[model samples]
Target: MAEHVTPPGIDIGTMHPARRYDYLLGGKDNFEADRASAETLLKFFPATRINALENRRFLRRAVTFLAREAGLRQFLDIGSGLPTAPNVHEVAQGIAPQSRVVYVDNDPIVLVHARALLTSTAEGATAYVDADLRDPARILTHPDLLGTLDLTRPVGLMLVAVMHFFPDALKPYEIVDRLVRAMPSGSYLAMSHGTFDYLTPAKRAELDALLARSGEPAAPRGRAEFARFLDGLELCEPGIVPVSEWRADDEPEPRPDPAEAAVYGAVARIP
Candidate 1:
């Protein structure tokens, strides 16, 4: 087993977005602080757990579409959370053994468990870069990402359920645009972002308050605002629908309620 030393500037006492998400996904890599933060959100919006699960499922489906359908051989997954079953590499390598992946996240815990992400098929490759999404340049230029994936080729960029953390001041749209611009013409962007479109004004306010109290406030965008993230890219079929409805493998089975799964998912080509 490989070991990764916890880097400086990590405060375990404070709640971290990745750890909170890990707890939401039923993973044991979270602390009490993370749990408390997750519980707070659930109290305000009972559908949060369901939404998290649906968003995760959407990620798997989108990756499958990119690797198995789009024939993309490389992936650059930004803000990739704690290691979970059927991860990006597993799904992609399962379809095409030659697939390559680069997982990027700023969380120290993610780095500690990065060994799980490093396991790749004999023909494929996997690497982890400890970087923040706010710094697209750093992530794009990281040696591990560059070593594992060829930027010149079509790469699937996964940004599932992660961008909401960036507020307007951070210019999330520009950040995503910069990343998309870095990829080749055929590269695809598979994204799922949290939204308040389904919530009542009161419920939305309560959710916002809870997020602020947690010390990591997130800005849940509306449908129109979220669509702007893919401005220059060409959207794929079943465009910008709720996570549960975006090219779902289990169709006609009464998809999860959009209100419960308040996250929008889509895939777009750079061209």
Candidate 2:
């Protein structure tokens, strides 16, 4: 059973924790319950706000690489969260101005926000699909996606900061496989996944408790397990690394151990 709360600006009946995360990120559209949940998360992890910002930064950089450096046009941003500034479409289209992007999320709140924020330039197109990562077939065959993206052409698959929700039961690897198999060769798979590599026993326990309280799942993977998702694809230079360390041009300020940050980011090309 789920509770219902009507946000002031948004009419989503029951919001997901991820939607609450958007509120924590300083977006104006989240409801009272979302704000409450976000506050609870901050009490558990004070650096969560900063971490979310860094992850958003990673999104911008990855999209730039895909659009400007790799010359890819179409994008499939699965699990794309609230419409933050410089979204995948904003970053990619800023570069080429003709890059088509399809944003996917299952949350009704996210769907409303997407319709509000996901406007495309005249030269390019942008559309949002209400679909879950677990439903790869529905997501891939979504009408809006098919109309905007050419399956035969290479596409950038953006799976940033969303796979941690899938526990072993869902077999996240197999889900990625289904989506990858559908894309043509030369397509890129960009991901930023959360892991438990750096958490102390006590801290991990605390996080686990928090997730349970909020009805969200926390399934953080290790470096080896994270690497397994990219087994067949060719990883870009620097391979898998901390979200803040990957292709970082400037020297990054020293922070907690890799396991503490507990997040990995990488991009791979399909053969």
Candidate 3:
């Protein structure tokens, strides 16, 4: 695979979730540590690449639904990873040119690349906030976010392929609810989280041990545990299914089984 020059000051020895995800998606912005961690993950979950692509496809479909069906024009995407094609703004603006997007991530590389390269249309607006997902208030109140998106209005909150990094100790549920509470009633929330529901008990144990050993912070919860993030929200159709099976009408034919993807995905509206 191709590689990009690491930006100065980044700890290249450590594995970053975004870079590991980019590596999984065949991108060129990962380091040796990231690739090694990804390969180690593949040992317990052989379909790691398929799971990553499935989650990426799920994010695109959710954004399309929000832009077209949900009639949302503003979006706040937290834990936004490396700049990939068809980003939140790219997908949203394609459906509605006036759509506004605020991408948030703690990774300096993501922030630098996104701010430097990500563009917006004349009608729509785009901005990047250098913040961590754990600090939802900071992201919601960032000057760049406020300048770009009006929080008083309904916003599509996206937390795709990123929550797995925050295990129970991080209180992921509370973090999600805090962000949701900042938005209006009609605002929509779209998320895809890693899940161990499809894995056997032994496999789950092995995966957990592997992650601990590799210093990878991937904590894939079960279905019931993952559902807590969307509690009290109005779930869209086909709620809480594997990312590969959630609204696969536009996906390529012969979708992968839920076990292969091993991630729960859904879209909901704050009521």
Best by TM-score: 3
lDDT of 2 by residue, 25-55 (tens): 7777666677777788679877677667667
Question: Which stretches in model 3 have alpha-carbon errors above 4 Å?
Answer: 1-5
Q: Please identify which of the two predictions, 1 or 2, would achieve the higher TM-score against the true structure.
A: 1
Q: What count of clashes does model 2 give?
A: 3
Q: Relative to the true structure, how large is the alpha-carbon lDDT of every model?
A: 0.88, 0.83, 0.89
| Model 3, total clashes | 0
TM-score, each model? 0.94, 0.90, 0.96
- Which scores greater on TM-score, model 2 or model 3? 3
**Candidate 1, pairs of clashing residues:** none
Tens digit per residue, CA lDDT, model 1, 50-155? 8988988898899999998899999999999898887999999999999999999988778878865569999999999999899999999999888889889999
Q: Which 10 consecutive residues of model 2 have the lowest summed lDDT?
A: 1-10
Instruction: Give the runs in model 1 whose Cα sits over 4 Å from its true position.
Output: 1-9, 249-254
Q: Show where candidate 2 strays beyond 4 Å.
A: 1-15, 250-260
Q: Report how far residue 159 has shifted in candidate 2, in Å.
A: 0.4
